[model samples]
Every structure is written in structure tokens, then in C-alpha cells.
Target: MEEEPCSLVYRLEQKYLNDDDAYMDQDIVLTNFTGSSPCKMASKRALELVVLNNANISHLGDVSQVSGLMQHVAEADLAWNSIRWECVKSVLKHLPQLRTLNLSYNPLDGEIAVDLPSAPLLHTLILNGTNLSLTSLSSILKNTPCLQELHLSDNKLDFSDDDESVMNESVKTIHMNRCRIEDWAQVVRLMRRFPNRKTVFLCENPIKSIVHQTPVEDLSTLQSLNLGKVELIFQEFSQKKLIQIYNIIDFLDRSFNDTTLEAQVNH
Candidate 1:
């Protein structure tokens, strides 16, 4: 049998790190590594973050080697790879401390043949550009009992009709940018599914107009909603009303102070 080469290497780019005190404690990053051997850094006890984006990983077995090094990792980025849901399931098995995981731009097609492993501490999951279906998403939600945020940008998620989903109270924020959603009713229905939703990102979606004039009844907990290129802030008065403000400005304007109200509706 051919030996798998050790491709995991410790890396730290100051530009990517933020000013968080949690990161100050023995932060270790392994990025842009090749092959399947992430165990090379197993001796590093303080390994907290891992970045394996675009690492040519195609098989499910490629990520099993990450178990040893990712035992203590809290964050991981495996974007732009050809890995599927099985590979993600394999990676999650060892990350007991994982809080945030990014698997964007991968071919993680629904494949719900088996339930994903439990990730009790995982709160944020980014599957942007992964083409995950609603059924697959519901399947994933069953195990991530504590997930709070879901990012699904660049997927073909058009909630134009009723679809069954697992009700998860833990999800507070959902990002569906560029998801080709056009119906407001469908959007409201999707939002109602996550009873605890606080924020929604619908930028770049094809929703040109709000067909439903009634304010979302179930989303009383929602605080912010992003639509198109502008942001819509929901504030309640004596009579509740949904306000949408549009501001147009020159792309070169450094000041970015130009503003214009395209339209407003009082309900």
C-alpha cells in the first residue's frame, strides 16, 4: 500500500486573525495542506483552528486523518473542495469542541442515507455554494441540536412552496443570499420554520417586490432583515409597520453618504 504523505503544516496569517483574547492562547492554524495526513500536527496541544480550503480532498477517507489533529479545534474551514456530506460527517466525528465549520463551495449534495453524527457544541455551519437541498438540511439539523446560524448562499433554494422541515429553536440567523428566492410568502414560511430566528440575509435574491403586505406574524423575534443591496430594519410602533429604505450611491464614493428612499409602505 502506498503511504499517504503528511500534508498538514502549521500556519498563521496575522491578516486573518481578529483581536480576540480567546485566539491569544496557543492558536495554531494549518492551512493549504495537501494529501490526507492531518495528523502531523497531533503533538500540538493548542491546535484550535484548521483551514483546509481547496486542498484537493475528494474522498471521505481524506478527512478521517483530521480526527487526531482536530480533537481540540473549535473552528474549521474546508471550503472549495470536492468533498461530500460523508466527508463532513467523518470530520465532525472527532471535533467535540467545534463551534464553527465552513464547508462552502463543495459538492455536498444532500445524501441523507444516514444521519450525521451529533455535534452538540457546533453553533455555526456555513454551507454556502454547496447546493444543499432542504431535505438534506433538515437531516443535518436533527443532529446539530445547538446550531444557531446557518449560511446557505449561492444555492438553489427557492422556497416558493410548502416544504416539510425539522423545527429547530436554536437557529437564530439564516443567510440565503443569491438563492433565487422570489416569493415573499415562501420566505415568510421559511422564516416561521425557525421559530427563534432573529436575523435573515436575503441579499441578491430575486425577490423584486414584497407580494405579501402583512407583516410576518411569526417572526416577532426577528430584528434585522437584509434585502437586495440595502438593509431593512424592523421597528415596532403603536401600529406595527415594515419599513424598507433604499440608498443609491456611486461605487467610487469613499464617503458613502448618498441616500434615497425608493419606496415605502405603511401597514
Candidate 2:
């Protein structure tokens, strides 16, 4: 975890990181590129995957001038960097063939909307710890409609007073782990918005009081649901409310188990 002297983004491994060249040229997978120094990368040809994990990248200062460094990149991991929200758009703009992108641990406080629809091939996006809001996130996802999995874990998303918004069609799995959501009504709202959604990770949310009537059909499409560590009662609930809670728990257990079995068979 020492400060690395200025180096090219491509030589981040072996020469640095863990001093292991295992990720040098393994079918476009890069790894162990941690440092507090700026990154400058240049190659004769375009690479497929580029990982700049924990590189302390701020505003993309190092490789701002590098032209076409990752034109053909399919997967790019820029996690654990303090990258500006504006710079994310520039990074994606540079890589047309990008399919997977990880921008976690970047505090993107402002409403920075990246034109993700441009990359039709992009499917999986990870924005954990980005502090993305419900409204801003909806705008972002509208462009990335083809995404299959979207990760927004630890983003501090407050949905207690949020209204329902439109969502992507292709997104089947959504991770909202530790988002601090308190109201169960908001959860129902999300289910309504994303009817095609198969999995929802709501672990560690401040969810309680499911007394309000929730239709069974509202969450019928859900295949996997993670409500672990979520409280279900606050005050003395009516018997009707307890019945609704039982119904949800039963549905989640049965539906998720069935989906798991199906996945296992397919794999």
C-alpha cells in the first residue's frame, strides 16, 4: 500500500501491485493495479479489458491525453478511485465496445448523467458507493436499458419519500444493499416500477412496518429477494398486517428457491 512512482497504466502489475505477472495477458483480464500515483497508458493496439483498481484516479489526470488507449475495451474496472462524475462520461466515451464497467467507491454527488445508451453492448454496471439518488439513478438507467445487472450497493439511497420512476427493461438483477431504505411502501413502489425484475438485494436496509396491504401480484415476477436484517415490525401490528407479512415471507422463500433450482439446472 505504498505510493507508486508515476507509471503507465498498462504496467500496473508485476512492475507494481503484487509483483505477480499472472494478469499480464490472460485473455484481457487485468488485476492488482493499486497505487496513489497517476496512470499513463499507451499501447500499439487496443486492449479488451482494463482494470485500474485502487489507483487513486482523480479527474483522470494521468491518462487524459492518451488517445485510444482502450478503444476496444469490453470490461473496465475503475473501482476505489475518487474519480469525478464528469470524468466517467469521458472514460466511457473513449471506449465504444465497453460491456462491463465498475465505478464503485466514487462519491458522484451531483446529477452527472452519462450517455450510456450509446453503448448498446454494455450490460453490467457497478456503481456501488456512488451516492446516486433515486431520481438521478432513474435518468441514468433510462439510457442503459439493455443492462442485465445493476449494482448500487452502499449508495445511501433514501427512498422513504421517493415516488415511483421508470426502469430499464433488460435489468433482471438489482443490488441495493445497505441503502438505508426505511419504508416498505418504497420497496413495493420499486417492485411496481421494475415488473420484469428477477432479483432484488435489499439487505441491511432500515425497512420496517409492512402493515400496508401489498398485493401478491406486485412482486410475482421476483425470483430472488434478499431482505435479511430488515425489521418487519415497529408498533403492534394489526392481524391483517401480520398476514400480509407472512404472505411476503412465504412468497419470497418459495419463489427464490424455485429460481435457484432453475439456475442450477441451467448451469
Candidate 3:
């Protein structure tokens, strides 16, 4: 197969260096260049918008050099790569204008401790598939007070009712699907904390434990719950037990519907 275009940044620079009109019209820019050379070039020119320069670059490497691009970026998508917290901290220091960041699918082991330097304006953050513990997650959220949306699915997050302080209400949406969490008490505690949050994706987790531990009437804030693969894996639960769990989920769904209706009517 032909090698993909390697000089994306250079090409972009050449294309719109003199053309003010083209620079002003471009809002998003995506480059699928890995390794060192292209990463260096892309990071160097990330802020120079050829037309109107609202730039967003994705699938680029060289985390060490990303800080330079932060000066001009409005949004950034660094997902599906191999960047770590050190890289994130470095880039965040220079991204004063960055509003959204997606770091999903990166193999980030160890703790997630990042004190965002100038990300007070940041609104959305995606950390899906990042191996972060509950304590580390709490640390990250403490600094990002303006965060609106957070995605933390597919990680080893600790679930215990005693750790209710971890979940923050400022977060409007959370995606924690396939996290192997089995503590219903902790789930209930989380729901109580963020009762007005828009959505929570909890599919492929152990819900049977919730059914046995907590009362069905407790999960009132759940709007869209996903238990699609629960039954397939936990074959020990009898048909009757499964039906009971579904009934509880249905009740929670109805509660969410009532809340939504009330809001609509009030509006």
C-alpha cells in the first residue's frame, strides 16, 4: 500500500500561508500521522489557522511537542494513541484557549493526577479506556471545576458506598460502561450525588448485585441504563431474578421520564 501523506503540516502551511481567505474558513483539521517527524511538524504549526483557524487536530504523536500547538487550538482530539499524564500536563500548560479534549483509548496506566495549568475554560473531557483508579479520577476532577461532560468507561474504577465523595455533580454526563463495578450501594450513592446529571452509560456491568443489595425504588435518577450483556455473563441468575432486575430498571426509567416531563412543563 502507498504510504499515507507524511507532510500534512507542511502541506497545510504551504496551502494557506499566504491565503488569508482559506485560513479564515477552516475550523477543524485532522491529520493521521504517527511517529516523530510528522508529530514535530504538526505540533509546530497547530496554532497557525490559514483561514479563520478554529483548529482541531487528531491522531498525531509527539506528546512532548504538543504544548507548542496549545497556543492556537480551540479543541483537540488526541484519542486512540499512547499519551500519558505527563504529556497531558505539558500540553495543558500552554492550551489556554482549549475548550474540549478527547484522550480516549490511550493506554494510560498508573494514577491520573493532572493539575490543569490553564484549562479553566475547558468544558468536555473524554478518558474512556484509560486505566485510572477512583482516587486518581477524583484528583483530576478536583482541578477541572468547569468540566461539563466526562467519559470514564472501560477502566478499573473502585465502587464502594464509603467513597461517595469521588463523583462530582458539576459533571453533566458520565459513561462508565463495562467497568466491572458490582457495588449497588456505591451506584446509589453516585446517583444521589448527581441526581440532575443528564445521562450515565452503565452497560455490561454487574447489575444483579444491585438487584440483590438495594431496593428497586432507590435508583430514581437513572434515565438510560444499559444491561444488555449482564444476563449473558451471569447465567446463574434465574429467570425470575432477571425479571425482577428488569422491573427495577423499568421503574427507574419511568422516574426519569417523569422528571423530564416536569422540566418540560415548567419550561
When 2 and 3 are scored with TM-score, the better candidate is: 2
- Between prediction 2 and prediction 3, which has the larger lDDT? 2
User: Candidates' lDDT values, in order?
Assistant: 0.64, 0.65, 0.57
Tell me how candidate 3 scores on lDDT.
0.57
TM-score of 3: 0.64
List pairs with backbone clashes in candidate 1: none
Query: For residues 65-110, what per-residue lDDT tens digits would candidate 1 score against the true structure?
Result: 3445556778988788767776667667767889999989988776
lDDT string for model 2 (1-267, tens) is: 866432334333322233234544443432333343212122334456777777666654444434455566788888877676566766666677888989898767677655533557779999999887677677767767578899988887766545665577788888887887777777778767777888888877766555446766777777777766544332345667656766756655674445431110010
Residue 68 error, candidate 1, Å? 4.0
Candidate 3 scores a C-alpha RMSD against the true structure in Å of 9.2
Candidate achieving the largest TM-score: 2
The candidates, ranked best first by lDDT, are: 2, 1, 3
Task: Mark the 10 consecutive residues where model 2 has the least summed lDDT.
Answer: 258-267
**Global Cα RMSD, each model:** 10.8, 7.4, 9.2
The residue ranges of model 1 lying beyond 4 angstroms of the native Cα positions read: 1-42, 60-67, 158-161, 164-166, 213-216, 230-267
Give every collision pair in model 3: 22-51, 23-50, 23-51, 23-52, 24-51, 24-52, 25-52
Error of 3 at 49 (Å): 10
- Residues 100-217 of candidate 3 have per-residue lDDT tens digits of 8877776666676556464677788878888776666666667676888888778776654256654565777777778777765556666655545666667777654544355544
Q: Candidate 2, 215: how far from true, in Å? A: 3.4
